[model samples]
Target chain A: MLKKTALHDAHAALGAKLVDFAGWEMPVQYRSALDEHHAVRTACGMFDVSHMQAVDFSGARTADFLRHLLANDVAKLSAPGGARYTCLLNPEGGVIDDLIVTRRDGDAFRSVVNAGTADKDIAWFQTHAAAYGVTVKQRTDLGILAVQGPQARTLVVPHLPAALRERAFALKPFTAAWEGEWYVSRTGYTGEDGFELVLPHADIVALWNALLADGAMPCGLGARDSLRLEAGMNLYGNDMDETVSPLECGLGWTVAWVPEDRAFIGRAALEKQRASPPRRMVAVMLDGRGVLRAHMPVRDAAQRDVGQLSSGGFAPTLKQSIGFARVDAQASAPFEVEIRGRWLPLKQVKAPFVRNGKALV
Target chain B: MSNVPADLKYVKSHEWVRKLADGTLVIGVTDHAQDALGDVVFVETPAAGRKLAAEESCAVVESVKAASDIYAPVAGTVLEANAALADKPELLNDAPYGEGWLWKMRADDIAAVDRLLDAAGYEAVLAAG
Candidate 1:
């Protein structure tokens, strides 16, 4: 049986089309996906990301354990409510998963990982954590709600806990604050100002109803995927996997090659590939009117294979199709994508096709 | 179940074809196919005067979820492709059988339309699988 979230019934009430995603029954869309995409871009939208796993690491040596596991230095998350986006890499420098590690109060560290890789990630964490005497506990009790877009913060604040409203508004981007079990973060996958709330399942259901009553559109995974793509955020399996490293997938910035002595798990492999990376990533927009779906082959003018689309789809805001192509490190601009055996021109552009409800590319 | 208009002949691939008085045929995806495709964003129809073989992937319909290839129901010469889809692809979702008609083609053999499934037969295809 497919696992259902606490809000599965709510999705059904909204007439959502549920599909199995990573072994969980989840809403792909409610009505029109395009409208939901637009709603998030222009106003406010909410997504039930309860399926994603939030694992808490606690122990005396939690800081030291994270430093040894993640590619990005955990030392930067020095204070409570601090957060860092990093990737868990295998010894060979390939990405196991990408996650956000938040520095919680005391000896606890809260990290949210993709739903599809949660189980495997817990196993990996358990394997590496035992040496440092850390305990890996998954927080299945929490339901994550991401309210994103221009008005996300405004629309969500009035509903926050009475005491937390002021502090929640004061939280800076990439930061989080907690009051008991209520945690609010000023971070999002969409390139928009927003709040991601982690609340108890029972509390979350109430909030969902309140938000809907107040006109916050309840979006689904369909809009979430497009919003992230437009925001230029990488999806775990689609963009990077066990086969590719951070350098090859436009995430070299996430790697901390500094401090010199931090012997992270994949440091040696990253250092080896640093001088001459085999693959590189590029952002492409179809010059013509057509959708670019994942797995489509990217080619040079001569039709020689360059790479493949990691995440590709229609950009509702731009009214054009856009995607990310993981091409050869040596590959240059003016790429072509093979669609139905036809070579369609794809123009290379700087990433983040949209941010904060504005077009960037 | 979406509307399967009895006046139109259907293909297992979910295309509905209508035989016009001039022996030309009008084609578009069925209401069921449109519902399955979600919000249509772009539709690429064949250019006028293009020739198509039976089962040829002659056009494309792109939704937010994914892109689907629209195959030709029978061998035909394209008369005119819908110009409105260029600007408003949502027509496919809003009116799959009317304003969303993909193209007009003169069939190589008008008998090809009779060979396609009627509404009841197409309903059976939906039922079996």
Candidate 2:
């Protein structure tokens, strides 16, 4: 059975088309994906991302444990209320998940992970944290809502507590703050200025309704996927998997290579792969009459099957089909995607096909 | 939801066919199909005068979310296709049963239309699913 969020009834009442996504019955779209996608790019949108797992790590060894657990050094989260974008990797240097770790205090931190990989992430943390005497607490009592877009901050600021609003307003990118019972972080998956609010599950329904009343459009997974894709964000299962390495999945920037002395779980394997990364991730925009879609074959100039599209869709802002593909690193620009036995011309380009209501492609 | 005209026939795969006075068949995706697909972005239709077999993929309808194949309801020769869909594909979502007609075919066997579900039969299929 698919689990429903607190906004289930609200979504149904608004005529949302609900689908079972990663075990959660969530809204895919209310009116149209294009409208919702445009709303997030131009104004403000809210998403009920409560299905994602949030874990609380406390005690003296919290920092030390994360240092050994993540590919990116957690020591960089030195200041309280700071946050770092990092990747949890398998022993073979393949990314298990990419997440944000927030420093709530000296010895307390919170990490939010992907919804589909929550169970596996918790298991990996529990198994590895045992040796370091660290406690991993899965905070299921909390609900997360991401309010994103250009006017996001302005829409949410009025509802925040006065003391919290000032501190949150001063938050830099990737930073977080704890005000009363709410944890507000200036971070989001969509490429927009927004906040991810973590509060008690009981408080979420009211807060979500208020956000809607405050001119924040309630978007669904359809818009969420398009916005993240146009922003060059990677989907866990689509872009990378257990067999794919971080270096090959457009996530090399998330790996911290400095302080050569501190060895994390996947350092050795990554060092070996870094010298000769196998496959490389590239972004492509369809130049002709075809929509790029996942599993479509990518061909080089010689019509050689070089790779396949991993994540793709019509970029609302660009008004074109764009996608990410794992291809031969030596492959050059201007490839072709085989859609229904026809080769459609495509141009390899730097990602972020659209951002902040503008087209970058 | 717009009305599904009683005179038209529908296929289980969501294609709608209207029989013309000249015995040709006009084909398009149903309203529910367009709604489920969200916003149409690009559409690929078969060339005029092409022969097709029943259930053959004759066109492609792509939305912002995914792409779906529009199948032929009966063996026939393509008479004409909507050229406007290439520039304004969202017409399929806006007026699926009217201006959104994808193609017209010279029906090879007129009896094939009887094999298709009527409005009520198609409605029952949707309900059963």
Candidate 3:
């Protein structure tokens, strides 16, 4: 049976099309994906992301444990409420998952991971924590809601606790603060100024209703995927997997190579890869009349097969198709994508084709 | 929902065919199909004057999420193709029965139309699943 989230009824009430996604029956779209995508880019939109698992680590050695487990340095989260984006990798430096880790206190931190990989991530942590005496707890009682867009802050501020409102408004990017029972973080996947709120699951329905009454549009996974793609964010399994390394997945910037004395799980293998990186992830904009889709073959100027599109879709904001392709590092700026046996011309551009309702390409 | 004129015929796969004043028949996907496809992004139609057999794959419609093949409802020779869809494919989602018609064909055997489902039978097929 497919698992359902706390907001499943709410999605159905709004006439959303629900589909099975990674073991959860979730809303794929409400009304139209293009409209929802435009709404989040132009104004505000909310997503019920309760399916994502939240794991908490608490112990004197929590920081130490994470330092050795993550490819990025978790010690940099020295200040309370600071958050860092990092990747957990295998011994060979292949990506296990990319997640956000926030320091709630000196000995406690919260990490939210993808729903499909939650069990494996928790098991990995448990297996590694035994040596460090750290405790890993999955908080299934909490519900997460991401309210994102240019006007997201304004829509959510009035509903927050008065004391927490000011701090949440002032919170820096990638930081979270505890307000009573709510954990509000100024972080999002839409490349917009927004807050991810973690609160009691029982209170989610009331909160969702309040947000809808305040004119915040309810969006679903379809808009979420398109919005994140436009923001150039990577989906866990699609953009990279166990066989792919972070360096080749447009995530080398997130790796921390400092503190040469401290070796993490994947450092040596990564260092060896750094000497000779094999492939590079590039963003391609389809210039012709075709939609870029996953597994579509990419061709070089000579029409030789170089790589394949890992993720692709039509950007409602840009009115064009865009995608990420893993191609040989030697493949230069111009390329083409094979769609329906015809090579559609494309231009390799910097990521984030659109953000904040504006085309950045 | 709009009515699927009784005079026209449909396939369980959702293609619709209407006999024009001339002996040719017009072909397109149904509104139900376009709604399921969300926003139509690109379309690939067969060239004009090509001959197609009944149930033969004749065109392709691509949305943001998936691609679908449009099968020929009956054996016919392609008479004309919708040139407007080449630049504006969303017409398939906006007007699947009118401006979004994919192609027109001259039926090789007019009796082939009798084998197609009528409006009521097509609706029953849609209601089943």
Candidate 4:
């Protein structure tokens, strides 16, 4: 049976189209997906992200444990309220999952991981944490909601309790704050100015209702996927997997290489592969008709297949088809994607095609 | 509730058919089909003069969620396709029965339309699911 989130009833009430995603019965779209996609781009939108797992770690060795557990160094998060994006890798230098770890204090940190990999991620954390004398607790009592867009903060602050309103308003990008029972973080997957609120599961329904009353459109997984893709963000299973290294998956920036002696998991394998990476990830825009979808073959000018699309779709913001592909490290521009037996040329460019409601491509 | 026009004919595959005065039949997916498919992003209709057999998959309607095939209601030769959908595929969602029509085809046997489902039959197909 597929699991349902706290908003399952609300989604059904709103006439949402429910589909099985990662074994969870989640809303794929409420009304038309195009309208929801445009809402986040121009106004603000909310999503029920309660399925994502929140793993809490608290102990004297918590920081020390994470330093060894993640490819990104936890030392950079010396200040409270600081959050860092990092990759959890297996010993083979392949990404197990990409997640965000935020520092609540020196001894307590919270990490939110992808829903599909929650069980495996927790198992991995538990297995390795025994050596560090750290306690790993998956907090199922909490529910998460992400409100993203240029006006997200303005639209949501008024709904927060008076004490939390100011702190939420003052939050900086990538930072978080704990106001009483609520945890509000200025982080999002949709490349927009927004807050991801993690609160008690009991409080989410009322919060969702309040956000809806405040004109925050209820966006579903469809809009979420499109927004993230246009923002050049990577999907866990689609863009990278257990066999793909962080360096090859456009996540090298998340890997911290400083303080040379800190031997985080996968460091040795990464160092071994750093000299000659086999694949490189790039963002491409389709110049022809038809949608760019995952697993589509990409060819170089010589008509030789060089790579495949990791995540592809129509970018609502760009009003064009765009995608991320894993290509040969030596592959250059003038690329083509084979769609419906036709090899259509693709325009290669630097990533982050859109951000903060602005077109970057 | 989806709109099921009483005068039109439908197929089990969710496509609706209308016999035009010129004897060519106009085909498009049903409202329920478009709603189930979500926002149509790209559509590929058969080229003019292409031959199609009954129940054959002749067109593709792609949404962000997945790509669905639009099956031919009867054996026919494609007369014209809705070229407008190539640039604005959302027409399938906005007006699945009107501007969203996929193609116009001259049927090999006009009596084939009588063999397809009627409005009530199509509703039963949706209800059974």
Candidate 5:
């Protein structure tokens, strides 16, 4: 049986096309995906992301525990509301999952991880947290909604409580504020200005409806995927997994190499791999005909195999096919992607193909 | 709930065929098929003059989520493929039957088009699914 989010009924009521995604019955599109994509880029749109799991860490040793468990330095988050994006890696330096850990109040931090990796991540946390004296609380009672776009705050702030309205409106990117039971974070995966609200599951449907009534269109996973891809953001399973490291996935910046004395989980293997990085992730834009899709082989000038696409799709904003590929670390721009027996040229860019309703290509 | 014109003939594969005044058969995917596919992005129309066998895959229609093969309802020789779709594939989603026609073909047996299912039968196929 597939799991359903708190807003599942609301999605059905809106005539959404539901699909089985990562063991959850989630809305793929409400009306038209292209229209929804435009809504986010031009105006305001919202997504029901309740399937993503949030693990709360509290107790005196919480900060110390996260310092050792994650690749990024949690100690850098001195402010109470600061959020850091990092990867949870295994001992061998492979990314188990990438998540955002936010420092909420004193000794309390919450990390939201991928829906598909929730069970495994919880297990990994429990097994490793035995010595830290931290409380691992899986927040199943909460539902998350991401409202994004240029006018997202203007559209969503009015719906919040009066006291929270100003705080949420004033929130800086990557920071969070708690208003009673609602946790509002100025963060999102779409690479647009947005707020991710985590509230009680019982209140989700009302909030969804209120947002819809207030001109926030209900977008589904299709638009979500395209928006994230256009932003050059990595999708967990598509871009990286247990076998791929953060360095190879263009997430080297997320790893904190500072506090050299502090021993992180994957530090040793990562230290070894950092010296001789084998594969490097690059942004690819298809220059010829045909859509670039995952697993497509990337060949060099001499038709020598260089790499393969990790996440590929049609960028709705650009009206062109774009993807991320794991090519040889020495590989440069002007490569070819083998599509349906044809060697088509691809233009490599410095990622972030689109941001804030503008095309960077 | 999809639009199924009574004058057209359809196949189980979701393609619809209509006989033109010149006896050439015009083919396109049904509205339901396009709706299921969602926001057609790329189309691979069959080449003109290619001979096709009944139920053979002739063209490809791709959406962001998936790619589906459009099959020939009857044996025919391709007359002309819709050239506009090479640039604007979303025409299929906007107008699946009218301007979105994939290709026109001269049927080997002109009467073979009648052997395909009618609107009611096509609706039944969608209903069963």
Candidate 6:
């Protein structure tokens, strides 16, 4: 049986089309996916990301444990409620998962891992945590709701406690603001202004309903995927997995190598690959006819196979097909991708296809 | 519950066929197919005057979720393909049977429509799935 979120019935009540997503029965869309995608770009949209699992760590050595586990240093989380995106990699320098780790308080931290990789991530966390005397606890009682777009904060501010309302706006990107049980983070997967609220299970449904009444369209995984792709955000399995490292996944920036002495997992392998990387991930756009999907081959001039697309889809905001592909580090622009027997020219670039509802590349 | 028109013939692939008096048949995806496909972003129809064999892949439907191939039901000569879908692919999801018709073709054998399942039979195929 597929697992259902706390808002499963609420989604059905709102006419959401539910589908099995990463073993959880999640809403793919409510009324229309394209409309919801536009809502997030132009206005506001909400997503029930309850399927994502939040893991909490608390102990004297919690920070030390995290510093050892993640590729990104947690020392940068200088203040409470600060979050940073990082990758959990195996010793082989392969990305097990990417997550947002938040510092709740001194020696108390929380990380929200992807829904599909939550279990594996928890197991990995628990295994590495004991050595540092950290106690890892899965926050099953909490659920996540992502409200994104230009008007997302306005729609969410009224719902927050009066004391937090002002602070929420002041909350910088990649940071968080919390009061007792209410947790709101100014972080989101979509490259747009937003807040990801971490609420208890009992409070999620009520807030979701209130947000809907507040004119925040309830988007689904479909719109979520499209929006993130337009923003050039990477999907876990689609972009990186155990077989690939951060070096060629358009996430090399997420890896912190400044503290050379810090022996984080996969650091050794990454150091060796740093001097001469085998491949580089590039964001690509298709101006020709046809959609770009994951695993599509990317070829360079002379029709030599270079690499395959990691993640791809139709960008509703841009009204074109966009994707990220891991190609030869030596490869340059002017790539070709064959779709249904016809070779279509692809434009490659370094910047994200879109950011903050604006086309960048 | 998907709308299965009783007058139109259906194929197991979820395509609906409307037979005309001139032995020319109009082809379009059914409501069930469109619903399953989510929002249609693009549709690639076969060129007009192309000869197609039974069960041959002739067109493609790209949606937000995934891309799918549309197949010809029986041996036929393509009369005309839907040009509007190139500009407005949402028609596949909005009106799968009307203006969303994918193509019109003359079947090699007019009696081939008899080999196709009727509405009830198509619903049974969907139910079995």
Each candidate's chain A: what TM-score? 0.99, 0.98, 0.98, 0.98, 0.98, 0.98
Per-residue lDDT of candidate 1, residues A86-193 (tens digit): 999999999999999999988889999999999999999999998999999999999899999889999988988898999999999999988888889999988889
Scored by lDDT, model 5 comes in at 0.91
After superposition, the stretches of candidate 3 with alpha carbons farther than 4 Å from their true spots are B1-7, B47-50, B83-88
Task: Order the numbered candidates by DockQ, best leading.
Answer: 1, 6, 4, 2, 5, 3
lDDT of 6 at A261: 89
Computed on C-alphas against the true complex, the DockQ of each candidate is 0.87, 0.78, 0.67, 0.81, 0.74, 0.84
DockQ of 6: 0.84
What is the C-alpha lDDT profile of model 5 across A68-180, one tens digit per residue? 99999999999988999999999999999999999999899999999999999999999878898888989999999999999888888878878889888889999998877
lDDT of 4 by residue, A137-158 (tens): 9988888999998889998888
lDDT string for model 2 (A44-84, tens) is 99999998978999878888889888988888877998888
Question: Model 5 misses residue A197 by how many Å?
Answer: 0.6
Identify the candidate with maximal DockQ. 1
Candidate 3 chain A minimal-lDDT segment of 10 residues: A284-293
> Cα deviation in Å at residue A242, candidate 2?
1.7
In model 3, what are the clashing residue pairs, if there are any? Answer: none
DockQ for model 3? 0.67
**Which candidate has the highest lDDT of all?**
1
Residues forming the 10-long window of minimal summed lDDT in candidate 6 chain B: B65-74
Q: Give Cα distance to truth, residue A51, candidate 6, Å.
A: 1.2
Ranking 2 against 5 by lDDT, winner: 5
Off by over 4 Å in 4: none
